[model samples]
Target: MQFIINQISSFLKPDLTILALGADTRQRVSWTQSQKIYSLSPKKDLSDIRGFYFQAARFLKRAFRLSPDTITFDPHPNFVCKKEVDSIRGSYFPKASLAPIFHHIAHAANFGIE
Candidate 1:
């Protein structure tokens, strides 16, 4: 998975550092720096709401330290990961844009789909 992210990062050439919040199931936090991607392991499921927010807070702090230029979350509207990103956007990352990437599209990209 890490290798795949690395390859995508190289190909995309995102101009700004990015933070990606994974889906509700195996919640993950990934960030990029100089085309190198780093990701936190899958944590608790975000469907639990409270627990998901707590863990998300921690990961957000870690991601913030990297001063991400953009923040991405799963497109699932009900996903707690999306809520978490929205909450932080108001306070921690007011200038950063919130990008909601569709879940399946992300999966396909990771698998090397065009």
Candidate 2:
């Protein structure tokens, strides 16, 4: 995951804090600073949009000291995860940049594929 993040960092803004929204089944949030990840949420099944939103808000407010300069989400148009992320971005971090990654590429990279 670190290697993949390193590779992808080239396409992202430098010196910016990032919040990464994990895939749907094992939903989680990662707070990234200086290329390292600090998990803000435990891996769990997020069953509904309201639950996800509530947890995300709690994590963002309680876990991290700084607001994210950017947020990342899986690039699947119909994905509920993406919709949730979009809601967060719109409601809380409207000025932050969004970096949507290709779902298959992220999956392959997680397995150490180039």
Candidate 3:
């Protein structure tokens, strides 16, 4: 997340306004409305993640109407492995701007004392 934030702060020019689609810049570390998410956990049976992703993609296609650039959060399969960075690139986001935000980085930073 810090990496993404840094990219936004550093890479994007000051004049260009950044419209974050799937994330809430206000909350920073938490979820917020208007940000759509599709979670595909093998454990859960109710919400089919892939199905939802397709739906979101369709919606985006219509909503964007062929915008120049788009950024999204698509986790890689190697997210569980030590190589949390590479998996998603091979599987999902070969094209288009994508960011991999590490949950553990945040968790470890916020770990509570027992």
Candidate 4:
């Protein structure tokens, strides 16, 4: 139950709604168009991935109101979340496009230099 949820909102017009999922370490859930989420991560250790999953799932169902047209997730083969992509997608965005993104690139795109 120890985690952090930070939502930063802004503006950026986009054709399709996009959801960006972070790697296991930061374990964030974010989106584009800037109005929904800035970044959502439960402040916790990587070793406790089980708890992370539960919290993530709960947060996903609770906070999200719209389904993204595309879903992007970290593709680390070893991470539990990577393997659980189906459940991660779950009733949340069954029709969304799911794609794999490199950890560094994904982070840079969102948290990188301007």
Q: Which candidate number maximizes lDDT?
A: 4
User: In candidate 3, what are the lDDT values of residues 10-33, reduced to their tens digit?
Assistant: 333333222222222112211112
**Using Cα atoms with residue i matched to residue i, what is each candidate's TM-score against the true structure?**
0.67, 0.66, 0.33, 0.70
Writing each residue's lDDT as its tens digit, candidate 2 over 1-114 gives 111112223233457787767676655556656655555444444456456654675556554454788787787877766777767877776777888987776677455312
Which residue pairs does candidate 2 place in steric collision? none
Candidate 1 stretches greater than 4 Å from native: 1-9, 12-15, 42-64, 112-114
A best-first ranking of the candidates according to their TM-score comes to 4, 1, 2, 3
lDDT, model 2: 0.61
Best by TM-score: 4
- Candidate 1 TM-score versus the reference: 0.67
Query: When superposed on Cα atoms, how far off is each prediction in RMSD?
Result: 5.1, 6.0, 11.0, 3.1
Where does model 4 exceed 4 Å of error?
Answer: 9-11, 33-36
**All models: lDDT?**
0.62, 0.61, 0.29, 0.65
lDDT (Cα, tens digit) per residue for candidate 4, span 1-114? 555656655555645677766666666666654354556666656676645765665665566564677778777888766787677677466778888887778657776321
Question: Which candidate do you rate higher for lDDT, 3 or 4?
Answer: 4
**Which pairs clash (backbone N, Cα, C closer than 3 Å) in model 3?**
76-88
Candidate 1, residues 18-100, lDDT tens digits: the string is: 77776666555567767666666433333464354445545556644666678887867688776677776665567778888
Better of 1 and 3 by TM-score: 1
